[model samples]
Target chain A: MKVHLFIPCLVDQFTPQVGIACLKLLRATGHEVVIPTNQTCCGQPAFNSGFREEAREVAYHFKTIFHDAKIIVGPSGSCISMLKNHYRELGLIFPESVQVFEIVDFLSQYGQSLRFHSSPQRIGIHDACHALRELKLYDQPRELLKRIPGLDLVELNDGQACCGFGGTFSVKMAELSQDMAREKVKTIQAADVDTVVSLDGGCLMNIQSTAEGMGVTLHAKHVVEVLADAMISTGEQA
Target chain B: MEFTPRSIKANFTESLKDFTLRKNLTKATHHTIEKRDALKAAAPDWNKWRDAAAASRRESLLHLDRYLAQFENQFTALGGEVVHATTIEDARSKILDIIKAENGRTVVKAKSMVTEELELATFLNAQDIETWETDLGEFIIQLAGEHPSHITAPAIHKNRQQIAQLLHEKMGVPYTEDPELLTGYARQFLRQKYLDADVGISGGNFIIAETGQVILVENEANIRLSTVLPRIHIAVTGVEKVVPSQQDYANLMRLLPASATGQKMAGYVSALTPGVSGGPERMIVILLDAGRRQMLASEKWEMLACIRCGACLNVCPIFNRGGGHAYGSVYPGPMGSILTPGLSEPGNAPDHAFASSLCGACVDICPVKIPLTKLLLQTRGDVVNTHHKSWDNLAERSVWKSWSLMMRHPGIFRIMRWFGARIPVRFHWGSDARKLPRLAKETFLQQVRDGRFD
Candidate 1:
């Protein structure tokens, strides 16, 4: 299968390791992963800020970049939702765009045929607001996470709550963002899991940054990173 | 008393951290959610009803001018006058004009937030009109000289003991902590005001465009007396409150009370048309814009779909702990966070947008499913774009300058990360007590050294 990687600009700049993990994971599953170098920001910042004109430019750029791919996959749930759900509002502006999928959604459908070695570990899942509320990707990611043998999925309280990293919202409304993030971190800590996993990188970054700042012991990782780790371990065992 | 987000956060954090407040909020929200769920379950075609209600509202809004004209014609034909007040001052003057004409000395009000918005009681008092709040909770808050804490439950933040103390001091009623006794005293005291008042003022929950009727749903039935016994009744409501028909009212009836008070039905769902036979001699409906028309033109026009059930208020995390006063507006909680800025001032409501945790609880509990969380995000964007745009512009320019510089050279970007990873643990951003976990000393690529990429 040919899969085009839309490495979100944030990942490319601040967290390239997540993109690398995604590439390794997809390749490990025997799919040809293509990186579109021209891929840039998803224009969520502009779009959410009501800069519809600038967002259109970004959306057109994205459609042109991934126009030929059979499947477009990205690690960020929010960005993917923008592409799949909101891009059509541009109307005849980017008509040639292909379907986009969050990494969890792509894996949930295709990874069913792949084998994995399981580990006995308890993990809590945090559902990013856009993925849960906008894309309705709640059950799919958790289902995919459960596919790994010996993994116990713990439910975090208010799991669907936003992690308070609403892009520029955190910086502009710093105090309120901190308050909300603190509550999220508190919920994750109460879950008493060794790690918190999510499909959205923005949420992970917010939670991770907050948890790191607080010296809290909870580890946060993207769902694809966990899958990649599992596949690596399984291959080593095999 | 406008609540900014900073104040709400401060108050909420103070309250949420308290065991008692958390327990009360959790218990109240859980109970409300359960009741609403049960109500939804009982109505087999609940979504169908919601769709019908939404359709009715949409139709009413689309032909608002026509229905309003029809309403005025019918109301006037029935010997009732319709006043079209484009602003709060106009609404107040019109009401005062009636008051002066009738030589009305005492007025009774039935818990109208519109009146609160217009500061009507204050205006009337300035003109020497004696106004009494007939709703039990409103009466308590009025005596206490505090604004309502919740839309339906005006004094929800006040426990019975507090009410007993307020009543004991103001009305010289005995200090009894019993709700029934307190309510009974309020009833007895307000009954005289209701019967003797020359004019009655109430907020319409819904205006039935079909019959030109004003509907007021209440638990205590005080509004019924307020409208019936008085020589005149003035129903002040936002233009968005109009609905197409009685059937639309019926559909909303299924959701409002249950969502509001966790009751299957409110005590009274009074629908008063013009010329109520032996009721008020004159009826006047005051249609107020008060920034509603501007809100309708914004991206958040759907917020007008709110039915004011107070369900969103009950389930909102910030509203529950911080209480209603913390929001500082007549409308508090999730709905207030969106509506206040739209209704009052937009750029001034920077704090309200940041008040939510974006928990999505309010969205889930809404009878109409208003997409509250998304709206909050949009409002947050508005707050930033409108209020902090200059600051953001400067910071973003600098950050993007750095980003473009790094992106221009991959070697520099890699080197920067290497150094960033190697930075001392103490240098990380955030609270001093909270330190980031030490980064892995080596990159994953280094750990996979000599591994074949091909």
Candidate 2:
């Protein structure tokens, strides 16, 4: 299988490890991966902020850039949702040849034969709203996480609620966004896992930053990063 | 009093500072969610029922003018008066004229959101016609001289302690924190107003066009009293409230109670057509347009499908945090955010549309399937287009423009990628509470090019 990696702008800039982990996971499942260099942002920021015309130019470019790929996979649920669902609003359509997959969905479907060496004894899943509600990828990631040997999957309270990192909404409604993130962190604290794992880079970044700012001792990481660490094999646990 | 300066950001910031109010709102909203969830889960056919209700509303709204006319004709034929009010002011004046025509000195009011929209009680009081609110929650807020904080629970923002305190301060009731005691006091106090009042003003929950009947549901018997105890009954409701037939009304009733108060049925459900033997001799129904027609004109007209159930508010995170007063309008929460902007003057409640996170929870929870988040997004687009460009809005627009430009050009993206976190400032609210993750040292594109994944 041939897969084109559409690393979201946020994942490319702020969480490259999640992107790399996605790559490793794809390769470990015996798929040929191609990194598309011409790919830029998904135009969701412009699209969500009521700049549809502006969003269209970038979306049009994105479609052209990833036009030849048989399969497109990304580490971000939101960006994938934008390409698959929201691009319709811009009067643009993806080529029927290109099938887009968010990373967890890709892994669960393709990584059946892959084995993992667990590093984290306990992990908590932070359900990103877009992944949970939009993509319906809620259980797929959790099921993938359970595949890692000796890893415990702890459920955070109110885990399905939004972290309020709604692209521009976090800044536009900063106070409310911060309050919501604080509540989420408190819920994570109650779960008492070593790290809170999520599939969306936007939410993970927001939670990581909010936890740091508030002096709360909480580690937030992307789900694929944890999977990559767990799949380092028996001898790689130095 | 005006709710605020019409800026949701400013209002939300101020509301955030009030810990007790946030806690109270959270408590109330969560309580409703628990009850609603249990009842909803118990019904295996809840979604089917919701579909039926939404379908009924959609059909009614598509032919709203025809349904309203049918209602008027049927009602008039049944010996009832139907007054068409094109605006809030018109509705108020028509109700006032009815009261004056009856030579009414006292008005017993039930829970009516349309009357709230009309500000009828305040207007009548100014005219020296005493208006007594018979709903206990309404009665408490009326005594305190405060606007309703919620549509269904008028005084939801106030707990029993605060109500007891307010009642003690205003009505000379014995100070007690027990809800039962407070309710009893309010009932005892309002029992006389029920008999003495010559006019009863109630809000219609549903208007059946085929039967000329007004359907109302309430846990308290106050609405029933308001319908029967007074000699003259004036039911004020929006034009969008009418349905085609009694069967449609019955289908919608299945969802209304479950969605509103999580009951199999409300404590009382009353349907009145007119010319009842011992009921009010003169019954008038005021059908208010009040920006509803304008809302119905747009592609977003499906919003008028609302049944005033307050279900959307209970599940709305923004509403839970800011409370109803933070919205500063007659309607509040997800539905209010759409309604206030749709009905009011342009630039009115400008920031209310952006108050949501686009979570789509309200859309799922809405019994009529209003697509609240989509309407909210459309409203945001309207606001952004029509907004008086403050420097902030201009700057924000410019930022989005730059972002789109960079996103379209990979060369520019590569150039900006070099400057990294400092170039964009990432999260704009850095000085406030939230902090954003620092940009990566080398982007994934660079890493992949350098064989990092190999």
Candidate 3:
């Protein structure tokens, strides 16, 4: 299968390691991957902020860049949801493309072929608000996680709550955002896990940054990183 | 007009940080959500019921003029008078005329948001007519001279200590932390007002077009007492509250109490037809439009589908933190945020739309599934397009122009990314206290070329 990577601008600039992990996981699962160099951003930032024309420009750019791909995948659930849900609205002006998949959805579709061995660690999952509420990706990540052997998944209280990192919202409403994020961090701490995982790097970064500031010991990682660890362990055992 | 968002935010910041408020809100919301879930699960065809209810509402809206005529005819036939008020001032004048005609001085109200919207209590007070709120929560808030925070649980923002203090200071009652004792005191105080008042004004939960019945649902039986004891019973409801038939009312019955308070049924569901067996002498039904018909005719017609269940309020992230008064309207939470702007001038309700996290939990919890989040988005879009069109248009044009230039040429886009990635961590947008994550030196594509994507 040919997979086109959609590195959302946030991931491209701030957390390229998530994109790298996604790429390695996809390749290790035996799929050829390509990243369209012209991809800058998904225009979600502008669109959500009510800048339709700027969003349309980015949408048109997205169409031109990845119009030929068989499968389009992005690590960020929020961006993937933007593409799946809002592309048609965006494509009203720039009507060129139709197919895009969140990385979890793509992995779940091909999950059986990817063999993995897992470490004996309890995994805490943070359901990103966009993925859970928008794209309905709540069960897909959990299902994929369960596919790895020897992994214990623990459900955190308010696991599906928002991480208070709504793009410009965090900075624009810093006080309110911090209060919400602190509540989320406390919930994560109560889960008593060595590792916390989520699909969206934006949410993970918010939780990680807050947890670090609060001097909590829980480490946050993307689900792909955990899956990658499981696959690497399988290779070593083989 | 009670407390502005700034003041509510200050109060909430002070209050919500206390362990009790968090526990109270979380426990109440969790229990309500669970009960709602269980009720939905028990009903074998809950979706069918939702569809039927929505369909019934749609049918009623379609024949609103006809139903209004039918209701008026039936109500008049049973010796009940109907008044059609085009504006708030007209409604107030009509209500005041009725009061004066009856020689009424004291009015006992049973938790009417419509009356609040019309500022009826304040209007009556200005006229030197004493108005008493009979609902326990409303009685507490009435004594405190504050707006009700939650719709069903009117005093949800207040804890026992605050209630005790308010009761002690205003009502000349002893301070007690027990809810039962406080409720008993409120009951004793309101009982006298219910008995002494010449008129009763209550909001209808649903108006049955078939039977000319005004239905009121409540946990306490104050609505019944308020309506039955007064010489003149006045039911004030928005025009949108009229459903087609009793069956439609039953469909709403299944959704309302379960969604609002997580009960299988409310403690009382009072449906009063025009002539009660030994009830009020003069029964008046005030069919108010205020701005509902206009909202129904506008792009945000789905807002009319709200049954005032207030499940949306319980699940809202912003409403839980900021509390209800920040909305600065009679209604609060997700329903209030969308409905306020549509009912009132958009400029007056400027801060309402920005109060959402756009989490869509309210949409999920709505029994009728009103798509509150989408309606809120539409409202926000309307606000931006209507109020800030020129500013947004200019900003969009400039941003798109640069974006078009970059997208038209990939080489420039790469260079832009290179620079964006190389920018210092200190170069951030918002507050100086928060630091941006350190940006990578190379773009993802550059790293891919360096075998990172292999």
Candidate 4:
């Protein structure tokens, strides 16, 4: 089967490796991957900021690029959420046949087929706010993560707590936003794990940035990065 | 008492600095979340209850005038009078007029956010009526010379030690950190005020349109006493508390107490039609509008569905960090972030709408399913597009304009992404706490074009 990947603007530019890891994971699972090069953003920033016209313009641009693809997957739930839900809120019609999924939600269905290799690792899951609450994505990623051998999964102290990178909110309410990020970092430092993984770029960026300031050693990874690293190729297992 | 002439942001920044406040807030909020979650885990029909409650609320709002009129007629037939207040000042004056006409000198008050909004106690005190807050939490905050920092748990920002100290300093009672002892002191003090007062004031939780009944729930039992002890009674509530029927109230009963205090039922769930025997002789219900009609007309009509459980604050990361006082309104946290602005005047609390990170924990736990995050986003849109254009950062809006321009055309974004991260200041709040990431050596699409991951 073929999967058309929509790499959100943030994942495409700032953390291209996450996009790459997602590609590797899917291809390894015996699926063909197509990267839509013309796609820029899912228009989350403007929609979140209440700039409807700007958000709509970018949203149309996005829809035009992904209009033909039957299945669209993205690494960031916040962006994919904007595509899945917010477009209708903008008074636009999302094509009925076009199905969109956040990568982990997609992976939960397909990830069971992927094989695991032996490796020693311990990591924490960020469970980003939008992914956790908006998508109601509780079991899919964790169930997938559990399939990997020799990988110990640790969850955040308060997994539902936000990392405080609310697009322009981090800048607008800068103090409380950072205070929230700092509190989130302190929770990580107090835990047994140093690595935090999530399917969200905003959280990964904010948490990592806040950790850097507090002199904490933290490794931020996309969930696919951890999964793709541990999973063996199907042919090799055969 | 002064509220410090500080803006909401400044208040939050100050609260964030106080280690004691932060510690108290964390402990208090976490305790509530844990209790609420445990109850939620046990209730298998929880989502169904939420749906039912939401439907009930929507039913009420959809035909609010009809329900409200039915409530007034039924209440009146039960020998109760309903007065509609057009504004906060109007509500306060109307309550005072009722008290003054009866030669009422002292008042015993229940914990009501509407009374707090009306500044009822302050106005009554100025008129020489000694009023006291009967709820344990409200009493603590009243002694502290402050308004409620939280709606449900008025003194949630304070720990037992702070309360012990406040009681000791204000009442000259010996300080004791014991929770039971503190309650005893407050109970002993408020008992006299309850008996000696000429009028009792309480807040209504729900008004049943079908039977002309007022339903108020509380763990403390103060609401019950606040209604019955005094000769004259006054109940202040918003216009939005109407429920279509007793059945709707019964279904909503499953959600309110469970969400508010994590119990199957509050210690007392008082259902009484005003002017009934054993209650006050003269009963007056003040239906305070204060922009609720405006809300009903706007997209934010759903916010009226809030039961004021304060569950949203308990789960909110923003509320955990800044506490409720920072919102600088009678209401705080997620629901307050909208109500403070969206109600009364849309521009009243200019900073509130954008205060959240749009986290949906509030929506997830809301008994009525108010769609808080979406309303907040709509409120934000209102702030930028309708109410206050100057409130949003000009630089940030322009960045969105530029970024959106780039995004609409991939060719422009292709070149822009290279220099976007280098813009340094970016969209303003790029302080050390919030930093932008550097551009990667290769874009993901570029890598794809390079035949990577083949």
Candidate 5:
């Protein structure tokens, strides 16, 4: 299968390692992957903040860039959701044959042949709101994570709650955002896990920063980074 | 007691300083969520009832005039007076006229969000008519001379210590943090008021058009007493509460208590019809349309589908943290986040729509299945377009505008990334508590193009 990788702008700028892991995972699963360089943003930041005209402009540009791909995949659940769900709000449509998948969903469905070596780490998973509620990708990420041998997936209490990284909300209502992130980190800390894994880069960024600011030395990694590490240990990296 | 000119952000900052309020809110909301989820899980037909209730609301809202008129006709035929109030002032004045005509000096009110929205209690107090809140939580807040925080649990933000203090100061009761003792005090105090008040004012959970009946659900018997004890019973509710049939009301009954307080059925679910032998002789049903018709006409018309069960509030992270007073509206949380902006002027509560993380928990827990998140997003669009003159909004818009330009062209995006990643661009907004993610030296596209992956 040919998959077009949609690396969200946050991943493109902030955590390209997540993008690299996504590409390696897709390749290890025996698929042709293409990263269209013209793709930068999915216009979600503008769209979520009510700037529809700005979002519409960027969304149109994004559609043109990814028009040729039969399958679209992204490391971020929210950006994928923006592509798959919110495009119709602006009257934009992808081709009927084209489908978009969050990275975990793509991997869980198509990467069954792929395997990982032992990492022996206790990791907690943070379910991003859009991914969990919108895309129903809760179990997919967990299922993929469990496939990595010797990985103990720690259960996060109130794991589905928002980390308060709401695009404009983080800045617009900074106080509430920080409070919520602190609350989420406290829950993760109580779970007594070594690292927290999330599917959305935005949420990881918030959790990572807020957890660090509290003088808590907790590692926040995207789920793919953990899986890619195990894959590299087993000599499965493409 | 008064609707102050406080921004949601400002109110939130103040509320955050109060640790007791935060602890109380978190405890109360989490308790309700657990019970609500358990009840939801136990009921096999929960989704079916929710769908039926949602469909009924949607259909009635689309034909609001028809259902409302049907209710008025049937109600009037039964010797009930149905008043169509176009504004809060209209509703208040009409209600006061009813009380004045009845020569009422004191009134007892059950939990009513519509009356709160109308500032009915404050208006009556100013007019020298004593008003008593019969619900324990309402009674507590009323005594404290503060606005009710939560819709259903009006005093959820108040700990027992605060309530005990209020009781001691206002009611001459000894301070006791025991829940049973406090309830005993309120019940004894309000029992006399319910018997003495000349008028009874209550909020209806649903107005059944087919039967001309008002269905009131409560764990306490105050609403039941409020409807029956006084000679004049005035039920003030938003026009959106009217459903076409009793069956629809029954479907909502399955959801309301379970979602609001996580009960299979409220202790008292009264389907009261006026002119009945036991109920009040002079029943006044005030149907309010304050800004509801405007919401009905817009693309975000589905907001009228709200049943006011308040499951949204219990599940909202923002509401749980900031408390209801933070929103500074009669309604709070996700439902309030949308409804406050829909009903009020654009500038009033303009920031309410942006107070959410759009987590969709409210939508998931809503009894009537109102798309609260979508409605909130639509309201945000309205707020941005109408009140974009704020410096924050202006700067935000400019940033998004440049973001669009930067994202559309890869050449500009690449150049910006190269310099932007190196330069420490710290937004002082939340930068103190949160450090921004550092940009990677090279993007995945550059790495792939450089034959690193091949």
Candidate 6:
């Protein structure tokens, strides 16, 4: 299968490692991975902030870019959801068969083929709100991590609660957003884990930044990066 | 402390800093949520019940005018009076006229958000008709000269000690923090008003149009006393509360208590028909249409299906931290944010819709499946389209315009990322709490060009 990689803007500019990890992991699963170099974003920031025209304009661009792909997968849950759920929501004329999936949801299918043998570490999971509610990819990501040899997954209490990095909401209600982040980090800490893995890079960014600001020694990593690092492989992209 | 929805940003700043308020809100909301979740987990058909309720609620909304007329006819045929009020002022004056005509002197009230919308107590007291809030939470807030913080739990922001102090100081009762003793004090005082009062005023959880019965649900039993013990009863409810039939109302009833307070059933559920033996002979239902018809005509009419469950508020992360007071409206939290802007004109609570992070927890927990987060985002667009004078928005619009253009062109996006990463920048907003992510030294586009993934 050919997997058209959709790297969200945040991952591309800031966390290219996540995008590369996704490319490596998709390759590990015996698939051809192609990075659509023009793919900038799924227009979540503008759409969420009430700029419909901008969101629509960017969304049409997205549709034009990836509408023909067999399967498009992204490293971030929120970004993938924007492509899946938001086109119709914005009243934009979108095709029904864009076929987009979050990395975990896509990779979970090739479980037997892909191998992860990460060193032993107990980690908590902060599933993104969009992935949990919109895409309904709740246990799929946890299931992927579970098969990793020696990777102990502890689900945090109040795991359903949002991390409050609502794109522009983080900037508009910065203090409140950070407060929510701090609270979530503490919950992850309560599970007695220093490292927390999440499905969305946006959430991990908020969690990581907020934890650092609070002077808390909590490491936040995306699930793709964690799994990609565990297996030795020739990282190749078509 | 005095604030309006327009001042929400300012209001939440104070609310967020108040440790005591945060503590009270967290304890109350969490306890309700836990109880509600427990009740839901035990029910095998909770989702099925929700679907039925949503269908019924939508059925009524689709035929709002027809059902409202049917409701008026059925109630009037049974000797109940029906009055229509298009605005808040109109509703207030009509209530005054009814009291004046009946020579009613005092009012004993139950918990009603509509009455809070009408500011009934303030108006009636100014008219020299003694008005008392009989619901314990309502009574506490009334005594404190404050508004109801939460829709169902009016005094949810107050701790027991603060409530005890309010009772001791305002009601001339002895100070005590004991919950039962506090209830007893409220009960003892309210019992007399129900007997002596000439009229009772309450809000309906639902009105069965086919049966012409006004339904009231409460844990305090104050509604029972308020509706039955007075000579005249006035149920001030929104026009949207009417369901087409008893069957529809019953489906909604199953979810209300569970969603509102996590109870299997309220302590009292009064189905008041005009001619019930112990009930008031002169029954008047003030069906309020304060901007609902406009909502029905608009794209946001799905919001009218809200059952005032407060489940959305309990689950909202913003409401969890900021508390309901920050909304600065009679209706607070997720549902309130949508309703406040949709039900009213722009500039009233312009920021309410924007305050949300668009986390779909409220959407998930809403009994009627209102799609609150979607509506919140849509309502944000409404706010932007309607209220455009914010100089901040003028600047924001251009930023997003540039961002969209940058997204359309990969070359521009790459250059922007190049600058964005090396800038070592702090955003003017939220910088106090957040730090920018360090950009990848070699962009992923560059990484691919360099054969890093080869």
Q: Give the alpha carbon lDDT tens digit for every residue of B350-375 in model 5.
A: 77888999989988888877888778
DockQ (CA atoms), all models: 0.25, 0.62, 0.42, 0.72, 0.75, 0.75
Question: Model 5: clashing residue pairs?
Answer: none
Per-candidate iRMS values, in order, are 5.7, 1.5, 3.0, 1.5, 1.3, 1.4
DockQ for model 6 equals 0.75
Q: Write the per-residue lDDT of candidate 4 for residues B1-454, one digit (tens) a residue.
A: 2232228778878988899988998887787778888888999999998899999999999999999999999999999999999998898888888888999999999988888888888888888999999999988887888888888888988987888889999999988998888899899999989889999999999999999988888888888888888999888889999999999999998888878877777889888686667778988889999889999899899999888888898888888788888887788899998987777554556678778898788888888988898898888777666543553446657877898888887788777666765665644245654456667878899888787765
Query: Candidate 6 iRMS, in Å?
Result: 1.4
Q: A201 in model 4: Cα distance from truth in Å?
A: 1.0
> Which segments of model 6 are wrong by more than 4 Å?
A232-238, B1-6, B424-433
Q: Candidate 6, after superposition: displacement of residue B52 in Å?
A: 0.9
Give model 1's TM-score versus the native structure.
0.86
Query: Candidate 3 regions off by >4 Å?
Result: A88-97, A232-238, B2-24, B389-413, B425-434, B449-454
Model 3 residue A29 CA deviation in Å: 4.1
Interface RMSD of 3: 3.0
Q: After superposition, how far is residue B87 of candidate 4 from its true place, in Å?
A: 1.6
- In terms of docking quality, model 1 is acceptable
Q: Which candidate model has the greater DockQ, 1 or 3?
A: 3
Among incorrect, acceptable, medium and high, the docking class of model 3 is acceptable
Candidates 1 and 2: which is better by TM-score? 2
Output the lDDT of residue B158, model 6: 92
User: How many steric clashes does model 3 contain?
Assistant: 0
Q: Arrange candidates by DockQ, highest first: which order?
A: 5, 6, 4, 2, 3, 1
Per-residue lDDT of candidate 1, residues A149-202 (tens digit): 999999999786667777655554455466567888999989999799987767
- Which pairs clash in the backbone of model 3? none
Query: What are the per-residue Cα lDDT tens digits for candidate 4 across A47-67?
Result: 888777788888888888887
Q: Per-residue lDDT tens digits of candidate 6, residues A1-238?
A: 8889888878877788888888878878889988777777788889999889899999889877876687889988788888788878877654555577898998887645776555698989987898899889888988888877898899999987889798999888887887788899889888999999888888988998888877888888898887887765644222
Query: Which sections of candidate 1 miss by over 4 Å?
Result: A9-21, A28-30, A37-40, A45-67, A86-97, A189-192, A209-215, A232-238, B1-26, B41-44, B354-360, B373-453
lDDT of 2 by residue, B1-454 (tens): 2456456787788988988888777788788778888988998998998898899999999998899889999999999999999988888888888899889999999998988898888899999999988888888878888889889988888776788899889989889998888888888888999999999999999999999999989999999999999999999999999999998998888888878877778999999779989899899999999999999998579999999989888888888888888888999998998999898776678788778877777877899888786688678777777773767668878887888888888888888767774565655353365656777888888877787666
